[model samples]
Target: MPRLRYIEESEKTPQARAMIESAHKTGAPDPRVVSIMTRSEIGSAWVELWNKVLYEGVLPHKLKEMCRIQISVAHQCGYCSTVRSNVAKAEGLTEAMIEDLFRYETSPHFTPREKAALRYANLFKQGEQAIDKDEVYRDLAKHFTDEEIIELGQLCAQTDGVGKFVKSLNVISWEEACEINPKLTEARAEAAE
Candidate 1:
């Protein structure tokens, strides 16, 4: 069971319901990663925009997954790291490769591009240190685009966005995130009253 509640199907407004339904629902389409934001379609705007950059963006799944997992770990967020692991698996990354994310520098599973991306993620998450290394940009640019870089930047930023709710709600595991997260039903209950 989750520490929070799952949104009920009926409780969702038609638009919000459709948005969630149409998303990539393999295990859980989009958990918003420990979000307590409204379950209304209003929030779907941000979701859709994200999908546009992620699912529809120029970056391939492998590259995107690499960045996602790397940033999630840099933030020390177990939830995001696990979610990225699953996504990477679906996209063809192996368990070894996923596990290697914590020590990717020495892992042979990563491609040059992937290693470069991971290095970029570490630097990106490291903040001010990024400015100290002008050399980092050359490495990052070989594997990413200005547009793709922007997408990676947003994904990195998500750690903090999701982290706030994750820590506040004490969300530590993906195994029971759905059962614990605030569900559509909960939002409806709140709106109706």
Candidate 2:
């Protein structure tokens, strides 16, 4: 169970209920997180920002989903790592692709552009210094425009920061995830190095 109580369905504001339902239907935001966030005054706006960033930006939803999952797996957030975006699935993102994400630098599943975005996400989660270097932006420029880079950066920042917060909420513990998928712990260890 989540450390935070989810706002009861009947008690939710109409807007909150709608957002939660949308999150469930779409799958990226995860209804559990949305339900918990709905208890806060900022819930609606945060959901809106999440939707716009993940679904409507110039960057492809598949790319953003890959980055989001990469961060989730690296951080060992079971809840976030397990959630899949329906839109991304429709766009041809598969479980196999996600499984190979950690090896993106050398994986045949990812194109040069996808590799660059995943590398950015990995570095972003590691620390500011890892992503702030000149070489990073130059590599990104080869695969993305300035505007696209901005959107990709936003996706990475939100996923990495909020994913940690969600982990702290005890929605799903790292140990619990390891129990469910032993490979996850191994992958996370590989990601840290």
Candidate 3:
């Protein structure tokens, strides 16, 4: 059960309702989070910004999806981890690729560009103080322009920060993720080790 109450259709503002409907149709963010967020105008705006960053921008949708899922898995937010972007799937992102996310460095499915983005997402998840900013940016520069890097960083920050909040909402916990896919826990554990 969600710790936050999902605003029902009747009570939702028109903007909120529209966002919830669109979120359901898109499938990138399950309607559950949108439903809860649309309760406030600020949250609704946040959802809008999320959509823009996720669905628009210079970065490939599939690449963003890859980074999103990787960060979600690292954070162990079951809700975020389980949600899939239909657009990304249609664009050729596959379960096979996702399965190799924890081992992206050695995965044959990703390109050098994709791997760089994944590496950026991984280090960003580790917290600001933990990263070697100059070295990370230098690596990213080889595969991405400054603008693309900014978008990638924004996506990682958004997922890492909000995913933690969502995990706390009881939408999906690490324990639940372990139940759903034991491999997810195992992969994270192996990564930690």
CA lDDT, every prediction? 0.56, 0.89, 0.87
Indicate which candidate wins on lDDT. Answer: 2
List the candidates ranked by lDDT, beginning with the highest: 2, 3, 1
Clashing pairs in 1: 2-180, 4-180, 5-180, 5-181, 6-183, 7-183, 7-184, 8-184, 8-185
lDDT of 1 at 87: 48
Writing each residue's lDDT as its tens digit, candidate 3 over 103-145 gives: 8899899999999998888888888975567888889999999
Model 2, span 1-193: residue lDDT tens: 7889999867799889889989989997989889998888886688889899999979999999999999999888998887889999999999888878888888899999999999999999889999889999999999999999999999998898878888888887788877877778768877878
Better of 1 and 2 by lDDT: 2
Q: What range of 10 consecutive residues in model 3 has the weakest lDDT sum?
A: 184-193
Whole-model lDDT for model 2 versus the true structure?
Answer: 0.89
Q: At residue 112, what lDDT does model 1 achieve?
A: 80
The global Cα lDDT (0 to 1) of model 1 is: 0.56
TM-score: model 3 vs. ground truth? 0.94
TM-score head-to-head 1 vs 3, winner = 3
lDDT of 1 by residue, 15-88 (tens): 66555555436322245431323253545566666555455567676666666655554454445545543444
- Among the numbered candidates, top TM-score falls to 2
The runs of at least 3 residues in candidate 1 whose Cα sits more than 4 Å from the true structure, single-residue gaps closed, are: 1-10, 22-24, 28-42, 84-87, 128-133, 173-193
Residue-level error in angstroms, candidate 2, position 105: 1.3
